[model samples]
Target: MVRAGARFMATGPAQSFLRRYGWRIDRALIKATKGHLSMSMVMPEVLLTHTGAKSGQQRSTPLTYFTDGGRVIVVASNYGGVRHPAWYHNVKANPRVTLTSRGYRGTFLGEEVLGDERDRLFELATQFMPNYAGYQKTTQGRRIPVVAFTEVR
Candidate 1:
């Protein structure tokens, strides 16, 4: 467990930077690192991609995901912000999604988990990335949503 003071100290800059440019910054970091940072240091199976939701336009982002029983789990922590992240809404609107990682590309179906199932997945996610606990803490009064994606044939 991260000390409360340390958690606060670390989150200040991280939250600020992520809020300002987390999408682009994390995408670039993932591309440059070739999924090394996300997979090894963070979680596994993250990619940067652009897709259209309601507007049928293009939206690109770098997100950390992991596979559990063949389902891909994604955290909408947004560092525990009050509202859901942009990609969360995008995927919610359009379940069809595309991803690219380490030279591998594919399409998948995206779905959000709720209630007890969501809680269970969130617990599993925290095991891989403890910072998620801090993110959950930072976003008080709000429930972080966890999204699951399954490959569409």
Candidate 2:
């Protein structure tokens, strides 16, 4: 994670450039570190594995996450893009998922929070990542979804 005060967030255009390509770099670091470091100082991240909604193929994405009791919370921000991310659709199609983070692996089920609950989670997420507030502002009516990955017994 990029430290809060770090100059990780550059200017608008720079940030946009990073948003487009930084994931590949982060993914390599994550692989090398075995999830020990996600390369973002802003917040911790988890590598989420799920089946593709359309292709029915397995896919993985590294995403920043927040802890909530026994569940892990994640936002489908997609860097404030207009459309919901592909992973979001995959999670919706098949809630079952695997999360690898910090030398731990777990089986979990993804569920989207809605309405009041989503609002609460959004607020909580903004606390961890102030950038989320900006992401929300650009979204207008298209809400960035907040999802919880709960462990399965």
Candidate 3:
């Protein structure tokens, strides 16, 4: 079902719809289910709360995530768009964040991985969601960012 959804999401119109209002729907469903349900019903989904980069206001975004080596990984693919998502910029400016995923909720420090680490994580991300590779191809040379979020002790 998620694969089919991903394929649909790849369409120009679907992308536009998702870019506009998908997050709201995801948030509503998550809230209604108390975080037990996500739009991507199979893969782990996260609700990340971050401080806006420019506005310095609190913002939240729902994202697909996967656990690897005790770290939670999320791809800032922006659905293959040319620019990084707004959340990515916020996270870059303020690495501290709050996350709720897989029934766990806590503070985490988000770090954008680079070099071999990034390559490895991105590969793992692709395995978790194959559409990501296709998203990369559409990125024109913007090398999508992969972030690792670790619980703050």
1 or 3: which has the higher lDDT?
3
Residue 93, model 3: lDDT of 99
Candidate 1 accuracy as lDDT: 0.72
Clashes in candidate 3: how many? Answer: 0
Model 3: per-residue Cα lDDT over 1-153, one tens digit each: 766766776788887887889888987777667678877766678998899999999988999988888888999999898999999999999999998765667899999999998999899888767889999999889999999999999
Task: Flag clash pairs in model 3.
Answer: none
| Superposed model 1: Cα runs more than 4 Å off | 1-10, 29-42, 48-50
Best by lDDT: 3
Best by TM-score: 3
> Between 2 and 3, whose TM-score is larger?
3
Q: Please give the range of 10 consecutive residues that has the lowest summed lDDT in model 3.
A: 1-10
> How many pairs of residues in model 1 come into backbone collision?
0
Error of 3 at 90 (Å): 0.6
lDDT, candidate 1, 127-149, per-residue tens: 76666887788787678899988
- Per-residue lDDT of model 2, residues 23-74, tens digit only: 7777777767878887675568799989999999998888889888778999
TM-scores, all candidates, are 0.78, 0.89, 0.90
